[model samples]
Target chain A: MGQDGSVPAYENASKESPQPRPRLRRSVEDGWIAGVCAGLAHHLGFDVRVVRATFVLGTILLNGLGLLAYLVIWALTPQALDGEHADAPRPAPTSLPRLDRAIRALRTSGRDEAFGNVLGGLALVVLGAALLLERHGVNLRLGLVLPLGVIVVGAVIGWSQLDRAERSSWLNESSFSGRRGVLRVGVGLVLTIIGVLLLATQERGWAGMGDAALSALAVLTGAVVILTPWGLRLWEKVKREQAQAIRATERADIAAHLHDSVLQTLALIQRKADDPAQVQRLARAQERELRAWLYGGGQSAETTLAAAAKAAADDLEDRYGVPVEVVVTGDHPLDPDTQALVRALTEAMSNAVRHARPPVSAYVECGASGIEAFVRDHGDGFDLDAVPADRLGVRGSIVERIERHGGTARIRRLSDGTEVALTLPVHRPVNQSLNQPVNQQTLPLKEAHDA
Target chain B: MPEPRATTHGPIRLVLVDDHRMFRAGVRTELDDSLPVVGEAGDVDTAVEVIRRERPDVVLLDVHLPGGNGRGGTDVILGCAGTTTESGAPVRFLALSVSDAAEDVISVIRAGARGYVTKTIVGEDLVTAIHRVADGDAVFSPRLAGFVLDAFGAAAGEIAEVDSELDRLSAREREVMRLIARGYQYKEVAKELFISVKTVETHVSSVLRKLQLSSRHELTAWAMNRHLL
Candidate 1:
């Protein structure tokens, strides 16, 4: 409903990009009211009560003229869920749930801000003031003719029609489709006729009609304030959202990396490696690196490395079928170097989440011996040699990231699953790693040496 | 129970309470003559009144009813469903909710509901469930039953553990320990147990006495460590 026609600011559908095809009906799994307003508010990012208030008031006012339209709209809007989508099939009727969610995903995506606060707050305040002002006015006031009228009309049509998909389908199918361009042409003609009528009635308004219009003419000049540096203002907001998006992608990328490549390779390495002592050493070494990357304190708005790890794990389990379990120690903040190391470990975990099968849980443990992480599955294990050589993550994310931290990285197969392990120094001094600026880009590894 | 084969049974009595006319109509069409819809009401007050008036035995109630999900229906199931027994017992209420929200489902059961079924049961399951509820059998959707049993089984485990622990301790000791563990600090535990702090301490000491423990930490730990927690 925002001007751009994206999902309304209240229902941030594309803001963080809603996860694919997970049927989330009004959470009949959890419903209080029709839960229609709640679902809309959830979709639009508005408080449910705010949506409900709008509906209640709209319904009371439009009960005579436009109520039927509202109900028709309700019957048109798709329910919050698809019931069962391709990603999660519906279970059989005879039994309990046999649904399996196969697609691996990450929940808790970056917070998307589709609407700014000031605009929303201003809309609420103005609506309230105008409603109060209407007490003194008689028939067809200017405010009622413009915004209030739209609110009444939209509320009646939008809220009711939003819930009824079949009505929408029928209208779209029966009316629009069969009649081809006739409906659109008819609607456009009606809108044009209304526009012409409003233009003709411009002089028929009430008191101050001319004087008020003259005074309003002065305010239009003040629009110069915003219009003067239009591109510059627009540029700033765009930059800000882009930066925010980048930060989100980086956080998401780190989670995906950990779950997919590093953990998978380490688990593989752990399984195939012959020397027990070497495996423990490698696993211990990888643990330290993972903690530093995830929990070690950093300049990011994100949490400590360990907390980040848990969030990543939770995100993995919730979004994907992969189950994640975490172990935290010494609730103290960890430095970014440690955080960076943990970031690498987190990537390994992401690899596991993506590649491993059922019953294979991603595990993370941090103690006095540094931090340790692993993705262990009971599914089929892959050969280290057979792993796709051109894989972007192993060459680019794992090896390159560990090398930057002056650590070693390895991948091998375990008896039951594959593991990716990378070990780095636990307590490297800030001065030693201070050669590069914090904002410097990570080096992309050359694929020629990866395999 | 073993999976029962679908039976060509006679019409089952059923009641539906939901505000949506279209959904109600759709449901009615699906089960038109397969089951006899004894009555239907769209709101809370009407739903309760209809159930009481018809006593149809299987009332399909929506969780998101006009007033609220199952507030009045739950009451009817728990406190007002059947005619007064010699013991003044109530009839069982079967809740029909669209959601499988664990809390709502359990609350209905705790309210003496005989069955809980979600609206997504399609038509067949919904019809079958009505007959089962009419027969006085407890019915729950497979997933919903899992949620019920998980909670019930956990509570059962706690009960078994508490019983065993009580058996493990002397009567007086068990009494004092239960009060203490229920968030009665030393002084409060003493007051409730009807003893002075000194006497309570002595009892606590002796209870630790029988349990073979030392220090309050060890006593609390001993109980917790023994899974008395």
Candidate 2:
């Protein structure tokens, strides 16, 4: 520990100290214990083997001072960033083939698997060293080794629980910080149990009945603390994969729709590009179909006021080769009353497009009060009363069509344009308990008018 | 109705802002020669720079653009908030879009645009709206009028606070908007409601001011849901 503290000051005064020096950090990837030896060897510009040999000899001859100093260095120095020594090679294979294979297995396994393998290998190394020293007539004390082993294993169990949440696969990015709290508490509880059991069994002989019971309890607690989170994480991963599969299915549905209608329309449009009328017709038809699919949802049979009016205007445009400007605001389902209103609007609009000048405007609005529409045209103003009975465009089609539905329609000629206004009240369910009168339904007239 | 209000100093200049090159060309060709194209821009940053430099009388701004931190046309209006023409008069903005979404309409209106029109409008009507905007009058298309009615009119069943008179449209204003939503021009609306065209303009302008200045969250949320429709 004293050497670890003095090394940085010595480096600061060396000949290469012209510039600011880098901070000392442990080489975790390269060192076997904690990278303290490798870090010291790099800083001192000495061979790592020489530094490691010095520490081992000092531990044997200097009353285990080297072991205490190594631990102190491990506590004081920070580990290097993850990839700092990624190019460093693994430990050379020992003459013992099985031990080498076990160390190699620890190198390539998952985090939890590597964790167990490292602990097992460390125990094996410690027991073999003790046997070797005993054969050399240097009796190692069982008292120090047994308690330290228990404490190190307990610390490893607690530390492994710290970062299981960081093992990112496709499970979840959110809820990880929240999951860490419960897992950390479980780890702390298991570590405390192991510590208390070790203290209580210290009076009994090591490897005796008390020790056996202590080990059994510690293993059971560790397994429970570890496997609960593992199972939960696996379940979460499965659920996320299922959600992804559902989304892929939806995408396939949309793709099928695009191929069936849109691609066919595009091909037809290309074949008739020389004829402007044919191309325009194809494009408009395709647009209506696509809009219905996109916004109409699943209810193709149900038509709203806006949809009905637009379809009527589009039909007129296609038949006459004339463009009609239709503007709609607010929309309601096309009930019987509003359907009558839409029919009246169609007659009024067709009159403006056929008998009047181009660029006529149609506007419709659906509101809480009722549905109101206007079809205006810039044409020669004519009086409603002066029109002959034979020409029933205004009287029979516009006015009477709406009056039959219990609504009203009016036509007025202004200085610059003629305006037709139609209004239909919305139908709301009557409450019988409130004694409200049910709305009277008007019978349909047999004569239909076409402008 | 041809050049009804004559400009003594020639036609009002225009700056077109839209992201699509084809749409800009189409609008340029469709516009009458009376409305001169002074400049054009494709994004919010270029729009602000061109408007500030050319000082056009009216700007036909597309409500959705590609720049300005994704706030799009609203950011252009704010970026040029205090800009004035060479004569020291404030420049006018007329927003245009292909869709009549209430949220986009309300946001652009609140950002101080004078009017909103759909891209499917007739060329003559677009010319008339541009002239109206340049003359410092608000132009409300049928859909926008209906949106205003839904937001501020009492027909929406919205609760009106005692102190929020400015947030509510009066009865006459509602009538005028309803007529406008029925595709009536201001002149025609004046004749139908037995009022002068100047009074009709006043009602529409007042409604436009309320739409821009009022911060009623309930009105905004109602417009978002399009419950009136």
Candidate 3:
């Protein structure tokens, strides 16, 4: 044994333990038909030739009783799994490797109680009898016996596949089993066809054989039609259960999101219920986030009076937790003059929303003549005459800014609401298209706010 | 502010139509006591029935309702098109909605509603709008003005150049709409544009007629549909 570190951990584990048990499975590598005789000889320390000869004789003397027993054993036994020896690399005896293999198989078999010992002994007897008959001069009909043997071998190959346990094991495990099953079944079918051809060509007609094959196919199709619905219902049930599991996982994800955001915000709002402003702020923030998440596709990127007003409105709403509705009729591209107007409008809107009852409304219209914006609130109107002109509340924020662009701002007190109207005339020279880019250097300082 | 309890004729009879029970209750409480609510309905069929039975001066129609063969407020407006008050004046519809969608606003307007106002409007402004609608005058909220300007301004641009006199906004009409969009009252818009208040109302009424009755503006309708869809 190399006993190197590269050896698999299982080999070391097997050596350290008392012994590694072997399972009662047919030998795939050594089998002539289904590997039953080879696996039996290996397990019982008998020669494989001895096992084979006994079965052949038993088939002749027992009137096919031995064949029936072999078929039953083949159906019950699992074929040796590929890589069984790979689990532990056993050292082979130098002179007699076959004997050593038998001994090793025997040793592994000893790890667990030997299964079907009586059946194994019976196999030895059959092989012994066949070996004796071969030694003697036994005259048999070669034509009849050869065809029957070939047919029986094909039948045995197909019968071995009836091991439902092994078939289903790899059927659930991987596609490799399906491929292997297809290949073996193909070989069995070819063998059976060759045997049938031989029997038909031997002083017989093909019509009878054709009739038999047609009848068998008809019976199989009838059986299939009668049995298909049971399998279909099983498949549908599996599919439905899979879909249900996926929906459950999605529900869990949504629940987690609600708990992390909505529930936490609700708890915070409850704690700050005494402060109406704080509660409103929290609730509004949560609602906006949830709506954006649900509807997807957040605000679009645009540089227009409407977009700027929306951004300003969103900012004020976030800060104060009050609703600001900004409605713009005609959109105009941002310019130096328009930028000044938007700044004044933002200031006016902030003052109205902050000091007055909401939801505040801002309306901006861009016509061929000019662009106008109004911020209105339905609170107690403020007396413009009472406010000092030196303060930055209205004069500095709204009136003076619009005056720079040769526009006007008016704070009118309506009977039901207070309105601040700001208008900026279209200043682009008649020659220039409104779509063309203008000189950016005229006002670079305030350009960042547009973004 | 003093509530206008009754006009020279009488307090304007009103019919309330909205799907949400809570919202209808809130509006009733917030409304001026002078505008006597004659009837109420929750869907289009009930609204048409109530309007025909009560002959209210103004019907506050919700844009999105649960019923009416899926057309909502538009169906109600069309269904009650022939209904009139006992005094022989036609019943008017004023749309109220929380939707800012241009399709919802334009559809109801096209279906013969006199005005459109968002639910966020102040109680006093809503009362004033209702009064104006009952008085056979068109009422345009700032948002509705914006939508109108957007729809008519860009749409039919090609057609407007070919025939500027028809299916297009005149300079005066554009100025009136812009002023209205700036939250200017009719009196204020007249003052700002140096026109009489009666002339301002005429401009607004003409705009409304062009918006609703113009069959030559197929391009406008197509553009609005494409923009909405």
- The residue ranges of model 2 lying beyond 4 angstroms of the native Cα positions read A1-210, A223-236, A253-265, A277-334, A350-360, A365-371, A378-399, A411-418, A425-451, B1-8, B32-34, B154-165, B168-172, B190-199, B215-218, B227-229
Per-residue lDDT, model 3, residue B191, is 76
The parts of candidate 1 lying over 4 Å away from their true place are A1-451, B1-9, B67-72, B76-80, B83-92, B99-103, B146-229
CAPRI classification of candidate 1: incorrect
State the displacement of the C-alpha of residue A319, model 3, in Å, after optimal TM-score superposition: 3.0
Global Cα lDDT for candidate 2: 0.66
- Give the TM-score of each candidate: 0.26, 0.64, 0.55
Q: What is the lDDT of residue A95 in candidate 1?
A: 25
Sort by lDDT, best first: what order? 2, 3, 1
When 1 and 3 are scored with DockQ, the better candidate is 3
Can you give the lDDT of residue B73 in candidate 1? 52
lDDT of model 2 at position A349 = 85
Q: Which ten residues in a row have the lowest lDDT in candidate 2 chain B?
A: B1-10
Show the lowest summed lDDT stretch of 10 residues, model 1 chain B: B149-158
Per-residue CA lDDT of model 1 for A1-451, tens digit only, reads: 1122221322342234344322223322122333344445554555656766777776677542233323322222233453422232222231211221110011112121112222222343344245424523644444434433433333332222222222222233333432532333334334433432433344544653553344233222222221222222234446556767988999998988687656865986668599765564455345544544544334342456646655666555545535443433222255655566566666766676677754443333333434444444434666554666544554356656666766656654544455555555555555456234333234454332221
Question: Each candidate's lDDT (Cα)?
Answer: 0.45, 0.66, 0.64
Could you tell me which residue pairs clash in candidate 3? A53-A127, A54-A126, A54-A127, A55-A127, A329-B146
